[model samples]
Target chain A: MSLASAPPVRARAVLPGFRLTFGTTLLYLTVIVLIPIIALVIEGAGIGPARLWDIVSAPRTRAALRITITAAAVATVINAVYGLLMAWVLVRYRFPGRGLLDALMDIPFALPTAVAGLSLTALYSANGWFGAVLAPMGIQVVYTLGGIILAMSFTSIPFVVRAVQPVLEKLDPALEEAASSLGASGWTTFRRVIFPAIMPAWLGGVTTSFARSLGEFGAVVFIAGNLPFKTEIASLLAYIRLEEYDYEGAAAVALVLMVLALVLLFLSNLVQIRAARYGAVTA
Target chain B: MTRALLIGLAVVTTAIFVVVPLVYIFVQALGAGWSAYAANIMHPLTLHAIWMTTLVAVIVVPVTVAFGIGAAWLLSKFQFRGRGLLITLIELPFSISPIIAGICYLLLYGRQGWLGGFLARHDLDVLFALPGIVMVTMFVTTPFVVREVLPLMQAQGSDQEQAAVTLGASGWQLFRRVTLPNIRWALLYGAVLATARAVGEYGGVAIVSGSIRGKTNTLPLHVELLFNDLNAAGAFAAATVLTMIALVVLVAKTVLEHRR
Candidate 1:
C-alpha cells in the first residue's frame, strides 16, 4: 500500500484507462440526456413561479396523477405476480404450446402502442364480441379506468416475465429438493429457498413494470377516453396542452412528467443493479 | 390439484387476453368481405397513408441502425470518459414517453422553436412536415439498436481486434474482416428490434406528423383515423397487417435464439 510499493495488482489492471473512458461517457451522456432535460426545465421556468405552481397544483393535475399512479401501481402488482407465474411455468415445465405461449408474451413488445390501444378498444367496446358479453354484466371497460388497467397490464406484462425468466432458467432445482428432503413443507421450501433467490428479481421486474406504465401513452390514449380529472393521464394532459397551442402549459406538464419519469428510472435502475448482484451472489 | 389449476389459469389468461384478441382482428377483417377490404385498401387516402408510412420507415430504419452501430462500437471498444453516462443516455428514450419526445423536437424545430425563425427565412418546413415525422421517429427508435448491440459487443472483448491489429491490419479491414463476422447476428437482432420499434412508433410521430388524412399518417395513425371514421373493418385490416409483421418478427427472434 505504500507509495514505494506498486499499487494493488487488481487496481493497476483496471485503473489505467478508466478515467478516459469515464470522461468520454460523461460527455456523451450529458449532451444526450442532460441537455434535453435542462431545456425542459428552462421551458417550465417561463411561467412565473406562482403560475407554474397553480398549473401543476390544479385539482385536475392531482386527479390525473392519482389515476396514473394508482392504475400503474395496481397494474404493476397484477403483472408482478402473474408475470412471475408465467415465467416460472415457461422455465420449469414442459407442455404443449409452451413455445407458442413463450413467444406470445412478447406481443406487447412488438405491437405498436396505438395498435394495441385500438385492438383493446375494439375488443372491449360494447358491440364487440367480448364486450358484448361483459356489457350485459355492466362491466364497462372502454373509456373507463378498467380499460386503462387492461391496456397497461397487457403492455407491462412482458417486462416482468422477461426479467424473471432468465434467472429462473439458471436456477438449480437441487436447492428446492434439498429443502424438501430436510422435511420442509412445499410452502416452507418455496419461501425459504426459492423465494429469497428470486425475490430481488421479482422486485426489479415490478419496478420496471411500474416505471413503464407511468409514461405509457399510446395504449392508454384510446381507452382512456381522455376525460379530464377522470380518465385523462399526465402524458395526455401534456398533449392536450400542446393541441390547445399552450406551448408553455404543455412544457410545464411535460417537465413534471419528465421529472417523475427520471425518478422512476433511477429507482428501477437501483433495483436492477441490486437484483443482478443478488443473482450473482446466489449463483 | 391447485398446481394444475394454476397452470390452467395461466393458459386461459394467455388465450383470452393475447390470442383471442389477435384472432378477432383478422376475423373482423375477413368478415368485412373482399369488396369492402379492396375498397378500403384501394382508396386513395388509404394508399397514400401506406406509402407515407413506408417512406418514413424506409428513412428511419437505416438512420437509426447507423447510429446504433456507431454508438455501440464507440461505447463497446473505447475506454472513453463518460462511458456509463453515454450508455444511460442512449437508453433514456425508453423511459421518456414518445409524446414528450415530439415536444422535445418541437422545441427545437417547431414554428416557434429555437431554429424556427432561421429555417422559416430559408423556407424550410418542419414541425408538421415529413422530415419532422422521420426525425421524431428516429428519436424514439434510436436506442433499440444500441441497447441490443452494446451488451453483446461488451460480452465480446477486444481480443479479436487486438489480434488483427497485431497482424498490421487497417481499422476498416479489422472491422470488416474480423469484428463484423462475429457481430452480424447481434447486429441483425438489433436491427429487427429497431425496425419493429420504428414501425410501431405512434405517439411522437402522431404529434409531429399532424395526422393529416392521407399524407402524414403512418400505419398506427391510419388505423386511428379509420377507427374514428367508423370504418372498423378498415382499421382492423390495417392493424392486422402490422400484427402479422410483429408475428413474423416474433417467430424469427425465437428461431434465432433457439439456434443459438
Candidate 2:
C-alpha cells in the first residue's frame, strides 16, 4: 500500500551521465590497471606451480625475501613508535615551527625516491655528515641492513603519522579528564584510554607502512648496496631478474611481494572498517 | 618538562630523519662551486631527462584528471552493487609495488609479451619508450585524483546536480556549472598530487625505461646514472631540481588544504 502511494523510482531521473561516466571509469581502469596486473598473474601462472615454488624456494630468492621482511618489520616497529609520538606531539603540543614540522612530514611522499636515496646515502656514507660522526662509533649505516631500514622508515613514516594524527586530534578530552579525576596518572590515562582509542588506526597505519616498506625499491637500492642475499630486497631482486631477462624469475619474485602487499592492504582495510563501525557505535 | 622533552625529541628526530636529507641534497649539489652545479644542470643528458620527465607529466596529468573526474563522478554519485569492490580496485595500485607495475606493463608490451608479435610486425615500440613511461606513471598515480575528489563529492552530495537536472540543464552544462565549480579545488589538489608522483616515479619508470641515457631515462633515472657514474655532484645537482619541484608541490598542497 505504501508502494502504491509513493512516487515511482527511476534510477536515471536525477543523473543523466551515469552510463557515460561509469563506462569511461571501467574502460580506463581495465586498460590502465586491471589488465597489466592480470598479465603479471598470467605470466606467473604460466610458469606453473612447481617451477614457481622452485624459483621462490631458491636460496637467493629466499634470502632476499628474508631480508625484505626483516627490514620491513624493523622499519614498521620504528615507525609505529616514532609515528605515534610525532602524531601525539603535533596534535597535543604547540611550539615554534610546529606547523613547519607537520608540513615536513609529507616530504617522503612528495620527494622523488631517487633523490631521497642519493641524499640519505650522502649523509650516511663514511665521509658524509652523519657518517663522519657515526664512523667514529663504528656504526656503519650505508650499504648495510641498517641502511635498508633507514630508507624504509624514511619513505613510510608518514603513513603512521598521518593515519594516527586525525584520530588523536579528534579524541574526546573528557575521557582523559575522567580517568585523571579517578586518580589515574598521565601515563595510565594514555595507556588505558588514549592508546585504546588510537589502537585501530595505529594498527592500520603500521600495516600500510609495512606494506610500503616491503615494496620499497628506489630509495633502498642506492643505500642498500644490493649485495645478493645480504642486502638485496625482494623488489630489487625482481628488478635484477627483469634486467637479466629472466622473466619467469622476475614474475615469481614479484608475485611473492604482490601477495604480501595485497594481504597487508586487506588487513589495513579490515581495521579501517572495524574502526569505522566502532566509531559509529561510540558516536 | 615532559612537554619540552617530547617536543624536543620529535623535533630532533624529524630533523635527522626528514629535514637533514632534504638539506643534504642542496649541500651536496653545491658542494663543488656554483659553476659545477650549473654545468650539471646544463648537461645535455640532464636536459634531455628533464625534457622527458616534463613531457611525460604533460601527457599523464591531463589524462589522469579526466579519468579521475569520470571515476569520482561515478563512484560518488551512484549507489550500486560492487561499489566497494570498484573503489578497492581503483586503489589497488597504491598497495602494489612500482617495480611490479613495471613488470606488469613489460609482460604486456615487451617483445615477448602478449602483443609482442603484433607490435613487432608493425615496428611499433611501446616498451622502453615514452609510451611505456607514461603508461606506468599513469598507473602509479591513478588513485590520487579520485582519492582527493571522491570524499569531497560524496560529502557535497548531488543536491545541486539534481536541481540542475530539474531545470533541464544538459550534462555538460550541469557538470560545468554545478559539479565542476564545486569540485575544482579538490580536483586541482588531486592533479597536483598526481603531478608530483608522475614527475618523481622512479622504480616503475626505471624498469620499463631500460635506463637509456638521454633517450628513455627520466630525471630520477638520470640522477641514478650520474650517481652510478661517480658523479655525485652532478647527481645531487639534478636532485636539487627535483627538490625544488617537491617544494613547490608541498607549498601548493598546503595552500589547497587551507582553501579546502
Candidate 3:
C-alpha cells in the first residue's frame, strides 16, 4: 500500500537571522509570560479539588462571584441594547458633532482604568453633579450595584460601539431600499433586516464587553465601595486574598476569573464566526 | 421623533458616562488652581514615580517591540512546525489578568517563592523591586506589538521578500529595505499602544512593587496612593499626567487611522 505523502516544509523568510530572532522570541515569551502563567496553573492545581471547592464555596467567595457575575450580566445587557443604538446613530445619521462623537468613542480605550473609576465616582457621588440631579429623583448610583455597572460600562463602552459601528457602516443600503420598496415600515425593516444582519457582531461585542467587566479591577475597586458580600467583586476579592498572604486562596479565586474570561473570549470568537457565516456575501 | 430620542439617549449616556469623568479629573486637579497642581506633580515622590514609570517604559517598550518584531518575523515569514500552537501561546498573555500575572511572578519570586531561596542565597531581589515591576509590565504588554504587526505582515505575505532575496539582497537588506518600511506604521502603532500600556498599568505593577513610596511606586500606583491618603489634590494632579498620556494616545490613534 502506498502511504500518503506529507506536505513540504515552508521556507524561512529571514534565513540570515531566523534562528537568532526565533530563539529570542521563544526565550522571552517563556520567561516573561509562559513561566508565570504555568506557575499560577501549577499552584492552582496543587490546591486539589477539595481545597478548591472549600475556598470557592465559602460564603464570602460565593458572594463575590455572584455579585461579579450579576453585575457583568447587567452591564452586558445594557451594552447590548445601547451599543446597537449608538452604532446605528453613528453610521446611519449625520449629526453636527458626529466626528467629535466618533473620536470620543476611543476615550474608553485610551483612558486608564483608575482614572475612569475616579471620574465616574466623582460624577456619581452624592455631592457630584450627576448624583445631585439623580438624587432628587430618589436615585443613588455611587457605592451601589448601579455604580459598579456604571464604571464597567464606562471602561468598556468602546468595545460594543466600535465592534458594531463598522458592520453598520458597511451594511448594504440596497437591502434597506428594497425593504422600503416592499412597503416595510422603518421599524419593521429594522426588525427584520438590520437587526438580523448585525446581531452576531453585536452579540460578539457585548460578550467581549462582559468578559472585560469581569476582569475589571481599577475602575470597579474605586466605585464598588468594597464592602464584602455586597459591593466586592471577584478580582478585588482575589486581591484581598493575595494581601492576606493566602496565595492558594488568591490563585483559586483568580483561576475562576480566568476561566470566565476564557469562556467569554471563546464565545466572542464563535459569535464573530457566526456573523461571518450569516453574511458570507455581504460581510 | 424616535431617531431624535435615540440619538439623544446616546448623546446623554456618553455625556454622563464618558465625558463627565474625563473632565472631572482635570477639574478636580485644578480645583486648587494651576500652581498647586504643578506642585503636586513636582512632589519628590511623584517625581520619582514619574521617572520610574518612564524608566519602565524605556526598558519595556524596546523589549516588547523586539518580541513583537521577532515573533512577527518568525511566525509569519516562515511556515514552521507548531505555528498554530505558537500563536495561541503568544496570545495567552492577553487573556490573563494583570493581577494574576503579578501573582504568578510572586509565586515564582516572592520571599517564599520557588526562586526565593536561590535569590536569598545570592542576596538578590526580584519581587517588590524594580526588576519585578519591569517583568510584570513586560508580561502585560507583550501581546500588543504582535497583535498589531503580525496581521499586516501576513496579509502582505512573503512575495515581496522572496523577490528581494532572489535579487541577491542580504537578509538584513531584505528586512531593512523591504520589510521594515512596509510594516513601519503597524510597528509604531503597536509600540505606541505598548508605551501607553506600560505607563498606565496599575494592578500588575502594584502587586509586585510592594508600594514602596518614591522607590518602586509607578505613576498609576502613585495616583491611587495619593487618593487613599486623602491627598486628593496630589492624586488628581498625578492623574492629569496619565490622562494627558491617554489623550496623546487618542490623538496619535486618530492620526494613524486617518493615514490608514
What is the C-alpha lDDT profile of model 3 across A178-233, one tens digit per residue? 99999999999999998888777788788888988888888888788899999999
Q: Over 4 Å off in model 1, which ranges? A: A1-37, A278-283
Model 2 lDDT tens row, B12-113: 999999999999999999988899999989999999999999999999999999999998888777766666667777899999999999999999999889
Measured against the true chain A, the candidates' chain A TM-scores are 0.86, 0.94, 0.92
Which candidate do you rate higher for TM-score, 2 or 3?
Answer: 2
Alpha-carbon runs more than 4 Å astray in model 2: A1-11, A280-283
Higher-scoring candidate on TM-score, 1 or 2: 2
Clashing pairs in 3: none
Give lDDT for model 2: 0.91
Predicted complex 1: DockQ: 0.37
Looking at model 2 chain A, which ten-residue stretch has the lowest summed lDDT?
A1-10
What CAPRI class is candidate 3? medium
Interface RMSD of each: 6.3, 5.1, 4.5
- lDDT tens digits, residues A1-283, model 2? 0001112123455788889988998888888899999999999999999999999999999999999999999999999999999999999999889989999999999999999999999999999999999999999999999999999999997999998988888888888889999999999998989999899989989999999999999999999999998999999989888889999999999999999999988788788778876861121
Q: What is every candidate's C-alpha DockQ against the true complex, given to 2 decimals? A: 0.37, 0.58, 0.53
For residues B102-157, write the lDDT of model 3, one tens digit per residue: 88898889776778899999999888888999999999898898888887777787
Worst 10 residues of 1 chain B by lDDT: B78-87
Decide which is better by lDDT, 1 or 3: 3
